[model samples]
Target: MAAQGDKHKSISGLTPHEFITLNELEQIPEGFLAEHSANQMEYNDAKKKFAEICEDYGKILENGKKSQALEFAFKVIYDIEPEARSIKKVKQDKMWNFIFSSKGNDGESKRKICWIHTDKAVFKHSTNPKEIILTVKLASLLAIETWKMLIEHAQFMKIDKVLLTPSAGAIYSLKDIRFIAARIEGNQRNTTNIQKIINASCQPGGHLLAESNYSCALAAVLASTKDMKNEEVRVQIVSKVVKQYFVARKPLDVDKCRIWCQFAFDGNYRMLNNSDNDVLHKIFKYAQKNAQIIKLREVEF
Candidate 1:
């Protein structure tokens, strides 16, 4: 996060509005890392296997292999984020909830995959958040097609999260946030047109730089202190993260500093004028001198 924040604000005149990893949550024990270590390993294995399948299928699709493309798509779904396994010995055996699903109205499915070029079309409005989330989640798996969907929809979805509750996976957290940044960087690196990359990046929340690993920590903190009345504490915590990021990636470019300032102070001041450069310079200057550790007000210890 520290590294990305520096690089992020250097290139763009905006900072990320959302990004907090599970590790950074004050109350959560560091040992939670040990617990998820196994799950992380499994996820990595699944990601690698899914990538290979997508590559082969991509070749077939390019050759007008419609029949094969559908077949590969189905297989990819089963492989990526499949239903949890049941253990006979474990009474607590239950399916870990999927971050997204795709088993509902065809129209909803199409809307969830709005970015993709497809022949199938739907002319109905979507009313199902559950199905929308599931469909979006399935379309955002590790495969190329899924990754494409993720890149196209991430910003739009981030904006949409303001309308939906956390229960539907609409909250803007670490994994979703980092996925946006990483996928954008990936696309920019591979594509030849610098204009296209810039246009795509300029979408909502494209200015965030931290990696996905930071999401869980941020979400945990928000969950632990939902009733706190101290906005300053929250601001301080966020400032600490931003300061560390800039210090590590020192002397941010003019544009990057602007973006980071926007993300950090998006609503701190009323936007009355177009003079953002002047405003951001002052904010970053303050951050540079006051990069100090912040202690939360509502600590459990």
Candidate 2:
């Protein structure tokens, strides 16, 4: 097992710091508990596979090395659509184009984004130069930093469209809130299937209604059972946000000069600390009626 603050991943998939947060929570959500078990299994499986990889590559001992050049390289080059991994970006009249597109006319839509789904990798065309490149290690922590940058200016906020990218898999990493083998669409060109999922998630006008966004968003941040301490988990927000940003032309531009947003209020972090006890119960049950998947905008800005 990896040590508390070491680079290695603990069996619970959380960092030593996260364990402290885990201990602070009062209630643990059921969905988070399910995800915690999945994370442990994923960690064990990765350990075994990584061992085989090291043995095959003749670096078993170096597996403990501080630098993970091989490990990180494998993840970057191993994306679903390697072709989309690297490409030149261009900006048109006040809008950036997803030039690496594989199909007919490029499609675009705008929608509200949730706090959880805020990764620049999903906005391939508008990735902020300052945004850290996505890697398996940083996927879970990406959003925290994204929001943290703005937190100083605005201490409280609300979010719509919590799901940032389209993905499906069984593993639970902080990235889905993290996924094991899920085909995440955040880092690549939105595939046909992924776009379909996003399309289904929005109104004809291409906007996400919070009516369905809050329930899943609520379910995502709840803590795990018995101090499951999944490091992949981000902090939870219980109150309705005072302000939220709509994804304008460029969500987060490298120049930091290409985006505009409509806004709304103040809410802070909280620990519900109850079992299966919903965080915002009345609201959760109502959002379930909509049952929509969280999604991000991908239309011509």
Candidate 3:
């Protein structure tokens, strides 16, 4: 039984730090717990913080006032689709809905969104650097708008935590968005309210459960299960593991990136293609080969 369990752990390619039991979760810092705990009291506090922030945000929007950077961002998005004035506009648009629909039986939608948002340029006719920059900027603005809409919708429904399906650009912006929430009514000083704004990029195989643009739904389902806390621990663990891999001069190929995301988010690797599978296998093999050099330590939850 011990050998079988070890084999399964090896096959899963998960380090000891990657899994967190309920008891382990209890030992996490109070600050971490406040932001991440799904307990009713903590969750309600997060919701109240979010509502206060949204109220402040409403005043800003009402006054036609925005930071210079935000003004630029809004302009860029409007340039892409003049009609995309708000999240509701994009959500109701037929084309946007189609683009964000489920990826069929396989998890192709996740990959498709990644490629389209990261690699595909909007102005195919122009190869100018300025045009390419504009295209990327527009995509990022749309992603932020989508995120805002999701937050508002969640608040209306009284949902406490939100999971985001972020583009590469959007992923980088998550910390900023969370900070915005923290700034509300001095919520930043309160450790418990800090992690209320959790976000993650869409893993390679996440579409099986969430399709494409419905990451908030996935968050709701996860919040209902004990796996939510485990998922948070796994994300922290895998992020450190991937960073270590990069520090060792390992190149992050597309397949490797996919594998890293899947492992980080506790995704179903079986839903990925054979190429991704091969990369995951290689990752485990490499970890074993360099175990002595890497000196990985178990992370406390």
Candidate 4:
């Protein structure tokens, strides 16, 4: 096995750190475990194929050396998707036209347009920069599902080969809450799948519905992405969440509550450049609402 931390450790006499993340393994998907388990036989076969490919290519000795075949073998055998691999981006050009009319058949039509292109093909017609941003936003709302599919694809080779960091698979690394929390903190874009998951967990009666917790958001994101659909293991997820919810008694004991606060109180203000005082004020308002609800409990006395 490739040595865990020491970059000097050898994989067939090659250091693993030359190609994989040193410690960011917690950002991967949860389905990796099941895929690894179900495909153990295939995984072993693929591992053998990978070793053969490495040996035949005479490239295993150079930890940084890479090729499609080698990459494919690692993806196939280990089911990891590294983001470092580069791929050609899709591109397109478009124009827009506008017309102002005051007379019949005699007015000249005015037009305004711009040409653009991008890496993702899902939004083929999104040529306007604003439109492209909107497309990404809308499409990203569907990220939970897309990410799930991506995770699954990495497992089965159902799609083209995906690159991966040799960081003990993606999901396993992401399980560390602190790491996910940091990603939330470091992200530049105001909106992201992680943010969405956090938001979902914070809404009233939302997946999280906690006052000062963080675990539910983590659990929800984990559960949602555990399979290709948030529904695959719905029963188990719900049961597990509900079980944990009641078992904790105090909402603070729930990890979900902390996840909510981390993003809500810390991530928004500290990471996203939002006004801390404003966010805190809003949070206080929400707290007052909760307090009001609790105050009404003694009316029958």
Q: Give the top-scoring candidate (TM-score).
A: 1
Write one digit per residue (lDDT tens) for candidate 3, span 1-301: 0011111100111111121111021132344333222222332332333223222211222222222222222323333234333423444321221011223467664211111122223323223211112223223433343334434444544544433433222332333334434433345433222222222123221111111222221222222232444656644544343433333233334433442333233333224445334534554455455542332233222
Estimated TM-score for each candidate: 0.27, 0.20, 0.23, 0.22
lDDT scores in order: 0.28, 0.23, 0.30, 0.29
Ordered from best to worst lDDT, the candidate numbers read 3, 4, 1, 2
* Number of the top-ranking candidate, with lDDT as the measure: 3
**Candidate 4 lDDT score at position 140:** 21
lDDT of 4 by residue, 1-301 (tens): 1112111211232122222332121111345333333333332333333233233222322334333323223322232112111211223222211111112255753222211111222233333322222122122222222222233333343322222223212322233334454544554322233433443342222322222123433333333333435443543443333323323232322333334334333233223123322322343343344432121111111
lDDT of 1 by residue, 177-261 (tens): 3333343344422222222222222211111212221222222233333345785565454433333333323233444333222
lDDT of 2 by residue, 23-59 (tens): 2312224454444444434433433333332222222
Comparing 1 and 2 on lDDT, the stronger one: 1
Lowest-scoring 10 consecutive residues by lDDT in candidate 1?
1-10
Candidate 3 Cα outliers beyond 4 Å, as residue runs: 1-245, 248-270, 291-301
Model 4 ranges off by over 4 Å? 1-38, 53-233, 236-301
Q: How accurate is candidate 2 locally (lDDT)?
A: 0.23
Evaluation by TM-score, superior candidate among 2 and 4: 4
